[model samples]
Target: MPASAPLPKSARRPRPATDYDVVIIGAGSAGLSAALVLGRCLRRVLVCDGGAPRNEPSPAVWGFFTRDGVQPSELLRLGLEQLAAYPSVEVCSLRATEITASDQCFTIVADTEASRTRSITARKVLLATGVEDELPPLDGMREFWGHGVLHCPYCHGWEVRDRALAVYGRGKGVTGLALLVSRWSKNVVVCTDGPGGLTNKARQRLQKQGIAVREEPIERLEGTEKQGLQHVLFKNGDKLVREALFVHPHQHQHTNLAEQLGCRLNSKGAVWTDKKQQTSVPGLYAAGDTTAGMQQAILAAAEGSLAAIMINEKITKEECV
Candidate 1:
């Protein structure tokens, strides 16, 4: 019989299952930073992101070294472009569905439109999945978030400097926020939103700083779509006009991915990680708002770099073993 051409395999080794030395979840500041480090080390790294960043609402992300006033989307785009230069790094524009540990490695399941579901095996996992902001139930509050009704003074304070500002504080942190906002605005009001836990000392401190302390419960927010916040409506049918409103949203972790992987969490429900960004679960690390309450992009990036170094070291040790 004539020799026939060799037959190609029906399924090619499935692209080696896209295995990696490190798998990072969430491609925000933290995950991208980690990818940059691991990729430089020539380690196979995959970053899975859902493309929904926590700071998407904010127009600009400040406090970064040189990219100050850069929009959040633009910053992420630049970061992704930088990471693309590394041949060892791959960015998957998808959401991580499930993660499980088995036989000294982590199995990550990601969902992609064309691929349906793809699995990756990794020696280490970094969780930079950030958090979600739970704004109070006030009318017009959500509509104007990031525009005029805002959070994080350092992030948005400079834009609204010297404007009439009001802070809605129903908790202990209100006093501190009021003081912080006062630095940017000469006219600041601390609205206690119905007096839940304001101490006499706290009230006096606010007054001493020329901050008006309002004990009325806010009913709703009044504003125009074009101009953002205009006034704070009270339960007693009173309205206090203001140019901007500062609020402290109840922040919550975006996913239970960390806790599900047996990582320890603090009393405040934040992921617990050491200075090296290693979590309670060995071979697993967490950074950014999910791990720390600081909630700043710069802090998240720093933590991610730390985690990357620690993870790389652990991987090296394992390879030697």
Candidate 2:
């Protein structure tokens, strides 16, 4: 057979499918951190986000060393702008719909504005897709959340210190949250909302600590729009006015992309990953609230950086081989 030259321009390798070195889903704290690291390493990266952050309802983000009280949106905007300096990193404001692996690379389909669908291929995938807090079905709870009714003491306890605080016994988190919030307020009330699994010993401990345990089922949250939460109304027509309220919301992973990719999940439904943030599925990794039980911005960012470094190293090694 005669030797044949390459085909015309239209019959090439299709430009290798525009495979990126890494594709990070969710541009929140974790995703942004990972992108920053990978960009600094001069890696080809793409970050797809829906712009709906987990803490969007929260007025301010706490516990970040120098950025305490920073608005979540402000922080994200600054982070996005900073990442803009890296020419290799691209940030697309889109929602990732599906991810599938093809040989050694992965393809990600995202839903952008105007309902347009876009796809990108990447050698590795980092899922920083955070979790969502399923709030209680109490009236006015959503309006006061992150203002006076809050979840994390580490995030909002200081502001309400020494005030009359109420904790809702919704799940296994009530006891722990009550104890922790006790440090912030001398007058703390734990509303069991009727019978719970708490033992007598636990009740005694709470009483000894000057924490009041109310067994009445809560009816609704009473508060004003401007002043935030004011009190809790009980089914018995009684009300206990409070300066602040604490409740651990039932949280669930916002996306099942990790599970769909065969990544192991923890007992809490969070994506299970190793120290390097690598999930069970090779080339697939997860970090931040997707894997962490204690969802904090700083911790998520740290995990993101760790995952980025691991990903960069893996890509470097593979390229060398």
Candidate 3:
């Protein structure tokens, strides 16, 4: 971002010895986008490339405008490359382990790849840490992750369209999920692993929609990585060859920083923020999957950009005062 007109020396606040203007945890789409914006505004920024993103195992990211079908790693590489233009921004592979707040600034303790610990301080903090998916505990589930088993139909549905697909879940949510998956494939089955916990009308609706319900308990999934998932074995000794499976797994924050800092969380456990993305804690902000139920790369990036701009504005007002 182009810098605004320089403030008069009388009105300007001298730079303190604080390590950075902002310390951003988790350099995913959100952190990277925030760093880009803050760097352009000439604010010192540090983005921690903690580890692989939540979608690291995903083959490709979809529905992102102008970058559809791009590999997840490739998109991150491009983001990092473009951020190189901003001298005020720094990206490091550090795992932030602890955080504490004081009157002067917030302190952060991070561990390097070599396991060396480093302490840093910043005037502001942004938590871009995403969420973690709890995959169902079933044999071959890990092996077929991102390939045979998936989430987010808009993200991976087109690839498996017209193929034999199964929706894994039970109760109310599974009913709607199965109906949604039916849009991509004609052969859709709901594997409830026992009683489906559906109302009579709900089951009738599913049947009318041409979606089948499997009440047999699942034994395990059988598949090869090279050819993708081939079969789902049931405890009743019946087996069905399913090309792909979809499930909306339970999710939780990838890191506990938000809770550690006393940021109020919403009912879904995501850090609650105002429209400007500032968390309940002053000078602290959250963006991306850390702040909302809806998860998407493009949406996370937009949140990051908005947070950065809001942070800059807040800092400017402080300086003027």
lDDT per residue as tens, model 3, 71-102: 99999999999999999999999999898887
Clashing pairs in 3: none
Task: Rank the models by lDDT, top first.
Answer: 3, 2, 1
| Model 3, residue 302: C-alpha shift (Å) | 1.4
Model 1 accuracy (lDDT, Cα):
0.86
Clashes of each: 0, 0, 0
Q: Write the per-residue lDDT of candidate 1 for residues 291-317, one digit (tens) a residue.
A: 966888988998888889899998888
* C-alpha RMSD between model 1 and the true structure: 8.6
Q: What overall lDDT goes with each candidate model? A: 0.86, 0.87, 0.89
Alpha carbon lDDT of residue 233, candidate 2? Answer: 94
C-alpha RMSD by candidate, in order: 8.6, 5.4, 5.1
TM-score order of candidates, best first?
2, 3, 1
For candidate 1, the TM-score is: 0.91
Which has the better lDDT: candidate 2, or candidate 3? 3
TM-score for each of the candidates: 0.91, 0.93, 0.92
Give the worst 10-residue stretch by lDDT in candidate 2. Answer: 9-18
